[model samples]
Target: MKTAVLITIGDEILSGNTVDTNSNFIATQLKEIGIKVLSIFTIPDEESAIIATLKKAFGMADVVFTTGGLGPTKDDITKKAYADFFEDEMVFSDEVYEHLRTYLEKRNRLWILDHNRDQAMVLSKAKIFLNFYGTAPCMILEKNGVYCFSLPGVPYEVKPLVKDQIIPFLKEKLALDSIVTRIVSVVDIPESILSETIEEWELALPKHISLSYLPIGSRVKLRLTGTGKSRTILEKELDSEIQKLIPLIGENIIATHEDKIEKILGELLIGKKLTISVAESCTGGELAHLITSVAGSSAYFLGGIVTYATQKKIDILNVNPRTVEDFTVVSEQVATEMATGCQSLFKTDIAVSTTGVAGPGRGEDGKDVGTVFYTVRIEGGEVTSKLFLPHLERLDFMNFVSQKILQDIVSLLIKKNKSPQLY
Candidate 1:
């Protein structure tokens, strides 16, 4: 496989003030075209650091990509570093200047062209790729048969440069193989046992195919990746292997395609023609957010309510005040009532509810941190579950509970016919 290295140059990233999302995005784009990212380095804006990292990156991989330190300001010294690294001198490019002037004039900001004119300066040996989104141009240089692409730090600019320009250039220049992958999401099973159950099938896999077990919350995703010269053949090979492995754990498999639980839930709801809503407490609308994160969720996601206070739960959801007074707010009884009330209020086919204590401290009712009770009411039947995860922090607890709730919803829908209670 062709290998590449990614270098992120920014003191803000090293200081944790700015997140390095460019490396991840660029690496993913490269992977889709069959380039394997070997290593990633995050360094400061210092010219010495840039030159040193470039040397290391070029030595490590066939291609090197750098993001950041391309602005007009003095701290943006990547251009100077590139000149020194390539033993070249800086030269003004009228082509780049005209592009910049036209770009700014179109935005009615041509008066500031002189102030940003330094952006038109380029290394004499470098090839310039115009930046339609921003002032800084993408520069490419070669050293000892290795290519390095320098890009601006802004994500918006980096995205188009990598996706629209650099990726096509690399594809045309290199002879690359095709890589295809499929994700099988499994639930209600432990990773070790699941692996052992499929060990026979896993060991019989072809050399070009690989499997990875990714455990998130309460679900395990089996990623089957195949690489070859032909994408069609690889996909068929992967599907064949999955069919062989299905009988081993078919009951545990929730989805054979989608990687995310929310997407899996969305597909099931849409396929079954079901409408759903949520009543969130300690989970605090996280369930709704996850559901709506999918495109076209409006087809099944009717609405949501976040009844955080005890009074709102009682007044709005019509939770019996006596139930909370007797069992506290974070109980299974309250969760069931909330789901029933939400289903009635929204008139959706399915209503989900969460009542939990996600906190650095104990809940108001003295319930320990990370105590959650969630209910999924479908039609006239309901299922309520409880989880106590004191090991997780507040945010993590909330997220885990929300993910588990969605996963359970998917599971219930899949087994709705088998289970008479859900009908």
Candidate 2:
């Protein structure tokens, strides 16, 4: 397989002011084209650092991709680094200059073209891929039979350049194999135990097939990847291997295809023709947000309410004020009442509720931070659970609780019927 290294160039990324989303996007695109990403490097925009990283990347992989540090203010540093590394000189490109002029003119910002004129400079020995979405163009240079592609930092520009130009170029130039993958999401089991249980099946796998255990929240996702020349053969091989894995851990598996819990729940709800609603407190509207994030979620998602305050919960979801007074708003009793009220209010087949203290400070009722009580109500039957996760921060606490709630709901739906519709 063709291997590549992704280098993210920016101080903002290193300082956590900006995330390095480009590496992940580029890596995924490369993986689809049968190129395996070997390493990812995030470094500041220094010419010495860029050149050093380029040398290391060229030594390690057949292809190298770098994103960021291509803006008008910083292009000189990156360009000089590329030229220094590739034994070339910076040369002005009339074609790139005209393209930039057109791009700015169309946007009616041609007045600043002189200030942005440096964006037209390119390595004398490099091939230029015109950037349609931005001023900075993608530069591709080759050294000792290895290829390096330097792309703009902006995600929108990076996406189109990789999709329309770079990916197609690599596909046409290389004899790439097909990579197929399948994910089995397992719940109610620890990762260590699950790994031990599937040890035999994992060991007996084919040479081209590989397995990875990815633990997300309370679920263990067994990602089985197959790589070969033929896509059809790889897919069939993956299916056959998954079928062999069913007997050992079939009962614990919530999904065999979908990766995200929200998407998995969405599929289950659509299959069962069920409508769902949520009443959230400490989790804010994250539970509702996750539900609606999936496409066509409106088919099954009725509505949601975020009753953060105790009185709001009592007023909107009709949680009994006496129950809140007795249980202090973050108890299982209040969670169950919220779920029931949400079910009645939305008139949906399923209702989910979360009442927790997600904070750096304690709740109004003095409940400790990360103390969550959630209930998943289905057709009048309900399951209430509690979790005390004092270690998690506010946002993480919300997200983790929301994920667990969705997973629990999916599990309940699956277990409620003898034969659940998973598709």
RMSD (Cα, Å) of model 1 = 2.6
Cα error of candidate 1 at position 163, Å: 1.5
Tell me, by lDDT, which candidate is best: 1
Worst 10 residues of 1 by lDDT: 414-423
lDDT of each: 0.92, 0.91
Q: TM-scores for all candidates?
A: 0.94, 0.97
lDDT of 2: 0.91
Give the alpha carbon lDDT tens digit for every residue of 1-423 in model 2.
999999999888989999888988999999998999999999888999998999899889999998888888844478878888888998999999999999999999999999999899999999999999999999998888888999989998999999999999999888898888889999999999998999999999999999999988888899998999999999888888888998898889898889999999999988889999999999899999999999999999999999988889889888898998897888999999999999999999999999989989998889998899999999969899999999998899999999998999888888988976443
- For model 2, how many clashes? 0
Put down candidate 1 lDDT per residue, 1-423, tens digits, no spaces: 789999999999999999999999998898898888999999998999999988888888989999999888889999999988999999999999999999999999999999899999999899889999999999988888888899999999999999999999899888888888899988898999998999999999999999999999989999998888999999899889988987899888888878889898888888789999999999988999999999999999999999999999999999999999999999999999999999999999999999989999988999999889999999999999999999998889889999999999988888765631111
Count clashing residue pairs per candidate.
Answer: 0, 0
List pairs with backbone clashes in candidate 2: none
What lDDT, from 0 to 1, does candidate 1 have? 0.92
